[model samples]
Target: MYRAGGTVTGERDAQPGVSRVRRLGTHLPPVARAPGEARAFVADALRSWHVPEDKACDIVLAASELVTNAFEHGSGGIALRMRFTGDCLLLEVRDSDPGDPVLHRPGPRSVRGRGLALIQALSSAWGHRRGGDGKWVWAEFQLA
Candidate 1:
């Protein structure tokens, strides 16, 4: 149980008709010398058993953004994972940053600082969790 705002929180309750795994996880190194390596890890792990190219490409892009975030801002390397619930894939990136990421909408001419926003727009859903030594940022995308 988790307590916040003086209230205790219970574990997630599965819906009566839903059979789903809402969580996925991985424990990655604190620092990846090359973000591409991290991207490859996610791409390979979550690649389609049948549709390798398309899924691998998407995972690579998202993973690149996530691992970059960890390498650039977080204290340690990224821990990445993905889950398949129905037709959705949730990609999670965990890092050693206690503070959550701040996503923003940048102006059209802005040259940087919009990666998370892009992730948010591309994915079906996304969020983060704070851990004792770090934070996790996750995004969910639907498979067509």
Candidate 2:
């Protein structure tokens, strides 16, 4: 289960319902493998939840971006959690760094820095919060 501060402890599932599915994973920092790992993790969860193909694709991409951002700016290990609440799929990535991410406009010649932008454009809603030990970046996608 996840603590009030977004720290993931024991993993558990609630009663079978819209909120029946919950999954969490932790990865070491440097996050070189996080994006791909995140894609697989979210894809598997969404598939189990019977999410539609299109929405699942979007969630995977958004999850990659969130995880990538955490690795880039966050310190120590990172944690990822996914859950269903009503008709929305909520994905959260927590890192030990307390720095808040900033959305910036990249230059024309920029080869990167578009992660958050893609997330903002694709997800129904997204935000971040400072946790007890670090911060968690989250994005939500409509499942209906």
Candidate 3:
């Protein structure tokens, strides 16, 4: 059993042209459907934020890939978080696996091992870090 939580907080200063930040997060069961669930969660959030469809699709795809990797390789629990600061959108997936994800350059006939590469191609930047409980893989997209 897992719970979902979200928080949105931001203020516009007198300097002008600053965007408010919005955030959402959830913990997901480590199951085969986790990737699909993650994609739905992200797509809903982006839609509510009025993110463009094309960009939203890319973000959702990235989230799916991260969640899939976590479900396949991680242990214990999995968590997902998203942040939108107007010009940028950030997606983070945390799992109980301490090992960092690797990006492999697969050969032409390779049947798998392209998730990280797809994420890199779709996102402006992506990385991972070890946490107290596990590790978090994050991706950032610059929105126009």
| Per-model CA lDDT versus the true structure | 0.65, 0.76, 0.84
The stretch of ten residues in a row with the least summed lDDT in candidate 2 is: 1-10
Which pairs of residues have clashing backbones in candidate 3?
A: none
Best by lDDT: 3
TM-score of 1: 0.70
Using TM-score as the measure, which candidate wins? 3
Candidate 1 local Cα displacement, residue 15, angstroms = 23
TM-score of each: 0.70, 0.81, 0.85
What residue runs in model 1 are displaced by over 4 Å at the alpha carbon?
A: 1-32
Q: How well is each residue in 89-113 modelled by candidate 1, as lDDT tens digits?
A: 7777777878879897889999878
Candidate 2 lDDT by residue in tens digits, 1-144:
112222333244655554444555555345578677777767876787788899889999998888888778876777888777648878888877788878878998999999989888888999899898899899888877
Candidate 1, residue 129: the lDDT equals 90
Ranking by lDDT: 3, 2, 1
Candidate 2, superposed: residue stretches over 4 Å from native: 1-20, 23-29
Cα error of candidate 2 at position 43, Å: 0.7
